[model samples]
Target: MSGAKSVSPENRTVIGLTFGNSNSSIAYTVDDKAEVIANEDGDRQIPTILSYVDGDEYYGQQAKAFLIRNPNNTVAYFRDFLGKDFEHIDPTHNHASAHPKDVDGAVSFTIKDKAEEDAEPSTVSVSEVATRYLRRLVGSASDYLGKKVTSAVITVPTNFNDKQKAALLAAANAADLEVLQLISEPVAAALAYDARPEAQVEDKIVVVAELGGTRSDVAVIASRQGMYTVLATAHDYEFNGVALDKILMDHFAKEFLKRNPSAKDPRENARGLAKLKFEAEATKRALSIGANASFSVESLSDGIDFASTINRLRYETLSRTVFEGINRLVESVIKKAGLDVLDVDEVILSGGTAHTPRIASNFSNIFPQTTRILAPSTNPYAINPSELGARGAALQASLIQDYEADDIDQSTHAAVTTVAHISNAIGVVSLNAAGEEIFVPVVPAETAVPAKRTVHVAAPKDGGDVLVKFVEGNTHIKVTKPEPKPKEDKTAKVEDAADSDEESDFSDDDEEEEEKREKVWKIGNTLAEAAIRNVKKGGKVEVTVQVNADLSVILTTREVGAQGGVRGQLNA
Candidate 1:
């Protein structure tokens, strides 16, 4: 069961697009071979920033460099506002003081005038900003290869819901890109690792720890035969490399504010603070391989200079909380996957923060025996961390093409099950005749997807409404308060005679001899036929139950007249 397979030559070109909060990357393969290229600035990663100037023109880094002089006209990091709601913004998280308004489900920010605006300000949609950045990347790649690029596979976070994914797709489409697929980040990483020549094919579990600029995600994947599947995923959007840098910057900022108390205006200090944050990030990286690093902040207000030196130990201490949060998530994910430390064969590290040695050391300490942390191999034209995702995406695109071309019959493969056995099957909740709720197990969890099973329920005696509540997951039924019993009539009691002892004994024997009551049969038709009749067109009708090796259940309908019956199997 070697994972290795040969790729066929194809006419269409496949490109991979990996977008992150702080940066975005693109990769492509030509004739089943990986092709690498650089942007017009000779850098693989074009900064994920956009600047709008007067006269209906927009720019990126070239425009960004002039931000200090033209802060009034520049807009950066507009991608953060894409697909976000007006009420979702937190002042603490957003750098821009003026919040953007919603326009057709997209945020629109207005570039305001510095002085009292006698003139009108310009407004731009978040989608338009994102489209500009995407188009720039696509156009740069197309120019470098001298071809007209059409389609791409974009990578997104595992936590992105349908709406966010849709917004991104729309943005890419607006940029003139025919999207091939939208893949999860860790899934892409797994694909990248699985494509390596030295990679082994087995049921090995790998966790991808992505610590990026604004978020962190940990995903566990298991490789079986030639296919890869996600076992579990967890992420914290607030935890990221930028926060780590800010932790260091905050400490330095506190000391600077104390020394120069008069320098209090945040707007005036924006450029200097931005520069300091960059220095902090560089120092953080440098400390990963070294014991100590020094950072200097030149010319504060009143011609004052400030400098600080931090050691590896101090940096680690400052980042202790971040490390703990990551460890907690990793451990939780392992537990959720029902696996122990011994089960994980590898720990694939990516993102900007993963480049730090301290972070790597912490991860090593958490899963020392089974984890093997590997840095992404550097690409000639791209940043190692940023390109890993895009390269992995490219590898997936190639695999998908191969898979489609072969037209492999998936039915030949054995269905994998998550549930070993149905100790307690899933059932619908219904109220009994006594007005008491009870759960009737129908189909259980870990039961394969698209599964159907039915349990017989009694029809109401009076033909009242009988609502069948089908709920997912195992939840306990709530008990209702019982009604008080009516008092028995005292006048109807028959007194026992105190006459002869024999007569009393005879009466007691007669009481025992009284006929034992039996439950009477009630007249009501079963609701099973009604349920069958209620099955809508194209809906699955439960008839027979079949459990697979994976503990998933499949339901077959009753045999049709004359013709053979159609059978439907459960999906994994």
Candidate 2:
């Protein structure tokens, strides 16, 4: 075993994980600096794909290449399967199918007949598939670092719920990582940009527009007192770079149908249509700079003849809907953040699709008052959209880990406390036996933790269990009564008779009545005043109650309990 002295802070590392619409990535921080170090593949970002081969071997990129040649044995693009049910696939899309048990819900793919028969029919859990992919990534990182990595900080979408967060945490555990924290993706990007000397600016509200192949997300961020906070976030899963490509595919399909009128086979058309989608994406990228570009689709069933030339303007026009969706998302996020367009100081663009001029131009038109967009200076010769998100995640992990180190000695104050115990019976203030409701509060959620209060309650005529249901928020407490409704006429008649007889009752009311009441009951002898007098200085008269993630309560007081300390109980 390695000695404690051998395990230094330098050996401790934090890894960041991000899953976008098109792909997913894992990034780790090396050294004290926030620079990102990629795996042995020389690519900073890894495609979120997985496949299993004979001899119990699993493959990623290389296997993806073999997908076209050996479709029976390969799998690709399994990230879409995350958080989806097996029967959720659309019937119209040929690619939509049930996920393999081994693959879980990370993605979908075609497998060999033998493999299918040998495998179980149940859908793979997202955690299982994500774990496999993350483990492979960790292995690659470990190989490069030549050290034992144990901890990581994964990134998820801002909208991820507790269950999704648990799924991610489980995957990290499966990948052999001790997850230190799970930061949101947009928050991570803000951290990445905020760390840069050129990117950091005080009192500036910046917008991050991320356009990936499968989805697009926009977030507004503000920095205050060296802390970067995400003001708002918006995302559209359907409106992505792929949607732009599909628009072009529709145009190409019309032309293909016009030329190949006799083609009838469904499989042949599917293959042709798939190829056209790829071509459309390539052409779309090409037209970003070039005024026009011509693409050729060779080896159609009829012959090598499917080809077309598209201008930049025509391509932009065809993809108008996608551009509109992006604009709406950007506007909506800014609006949600309670900021006007002019309030934005800078606009930072990232993601794979941001490489297109049309995307940038659309953003410019929307935010005309803002300065030109700012992006990392990259070699125009080769561009990879995946690098931005990964780098951002790495930067975030570094910032958080650094903050943890710097603020090690600083204590965090508790924002909320738990309730100890109910002091008084909560009931509505009512008049007479009829009980007209007024103010009522049995228990409030924000009561101090581990608190005990003695409440005086009226004994019910018919003794039974007094059901106590704790509620939260500013609303009237609901009560269930066993008695039926009383007649209004009977109540009115009693009030009328009492008013008429009250004149003589007041005649005997003054000095004699006051002396008689004082002799009967002391006015100053209330239980509340007596309890307050006994409360000693520095002594916990009221217990502080704290609730945990499992909704368990921890009761602390000045005096210790028989268990040798404070009382702690887990609620069933």
Candidate 3:
């Protein structure tokens, strides 16, 4: 409440907020790049956690340390319960803390202010918890910026419903932050990789996978004419980086048990289990960077110290099933968009879990050779995945922070506008090196009318006249498998089994057929056709398409640098 302020175009100071379920990050841009701000304790990746000691507030990593010693007073993992009833929410992750309970029909936690045995605990609603966390976050940003933060663009998950957004907005408002916009986590990641709406970027498809501490989300997006459309998405709450940490914890727990036959299971003891969890997470982070890491905990269980070491390969082997499952999740999301492995042009990995090299290698194995992976394990130039969401939101805030509030609201409000949108993509049909029909989209589907898009079409390799046909297109994958090598005759079954050469050839061919499943693009209905003649070799054609609010379409075509372009209108 102390930091609340009014924003004007001249005095606006905007920041980005990524309110993740497990961790939250804040960022701001001074030039072209967004820098994630570190708190006074020097943590860019701050834990979304809070603790109470004698009514004093503790936050971020500092609060996280209290989980082991003062679990009863610490609050963690409360982001997912916002805007939901106590009866409908799950509290599995809250067992180590002051667990969520129904208080006046709302999700709330009872936290004791002091360690005194008879002290009464206070009931705090989930919304209040979120508001307190946001206040601290925004206050930190203000201290770092040397100015009062006026507005922010926050990132949320795609699965967040309308009620959740409203609740988050209310919490932000209570924290003295003006809500500029609420962006999707995947879309924010995409923007961090330079997918700006005003840039004239080529059309392509991208898969954004965010494997977080508590959940995993994969999205299939189409980037057409500088506009992005989220075609499909998938989410999993049970699988993520926590699962990997549990594996390491269990490994050391079992080792401790084997070494000390007289002691009970460390997991059965709350403090011992907490130590294992903390060390396991540290070891997991260590393994992300080096070939080998050591796990050590002092006075782990039953007055015994536990120490162990694990190599990267050993860790990978233990977590191989998780890697495989993540790959399957990625594959299923792509397919849900009616696409194949080859159709994805780029794969952007986000979140802390994506730092694992094994996960990057798993992604490499599933996507095609041409697909570019923007992860530290694959691309040396890629941004840190953990900071992508916040950075994107910051970039967006910087771009629109100078605009008038009324104008910004009008552009993003769906109910306030009378504009219509096209339901399908419009593109040109061309021939590739093999003379196969290739549809080059200029206007993507769901573009609001009246809309306009421009693209340059290349001439034939030898530089001849080009004929381009404008068509309305719907994406459909046509699978093509090579003809299988003729099967061995039944009479030669025994001979073939004994002949190693024939068996090797058959196996090789069969594997090739099974693995080379190509997703070929097929041409859709033609809407208009235009031909440019007398173009010199190495010449290029410029094509522009525009759709009016009345659903009428107009197309213009001409050779680059040539006068008097051709223009035609058609009623659809």
Tens digit of per-residue lDDT, candidate 2, span 1-572: 11111112455666666655345666665553354556666645555655555424354455444433444444445554455555653322225222344344343444442445566433345556577777877777677667766666666666666656666666667677755555666556656666555554454566878777776878876643234457678888777887888888778777667777775421255456556765787788788668998877775444546788889878877877777778789999988976656556667777777777766666665564444455433223222345555656665556555444323213111110011322222222312367642323322222322333222333233423222112222332233333433666667745655664452221222222221111011112111111122222233222333444344434332221112323334362
The ten-residue window of minimal lDDT in model 2 covers 517-526
Clashes of 1: 6
Cα lDDT of model 3 by residue, 1-572, tens digit: 12323366787889998988789999999766788999889999999999998778999999999989989889998898989888889888888787998987799988886667687888889999999999999999999999988799898888888888888888888888887777888878988887343434766788999999888999887765545667789998766898899999999899999999988899998999888988999999999999999999988988899899999989988887777778878999988877777878899999999999988877776776799998998988788999999998998888778876665665653311223667677889878889888888888765656778889988786776678799987666555665655676645644654563433321322234343556544568888898888777888888999998798999999989999778899886
Task: Let me know the TM-score candidate 1 reaches against the reference structure.
Answer: 0.64
Model 3 per-residue lDDT at 300: 92
Candidates ranked, most accurate by TM-score first:
3, 1, 2
TM-scores of all predicted structures: 0.64, 0.60, 0.86
Q: Candidate 3 lDDT (Cα, whole model)?
A: 0.83
Winner of 1 and 2 under lDDT: 1
Give me the candidate number with maximum TM-score: 3
Query: What do the candidate models score in CA lDDT, each in turn?
Result: 0.59, 0.53, 0.83
- The reply for model 1, stretches above 4 Å from the true place, is 1-12, 30-36, 54-81, 89-93, 96-99, 103-105, 112-119, 255-268, 376-383, 400-572
Cα lDDT, model 2, residue 419: 17
By TM-score, is 2 or 3 better? Answer: 3
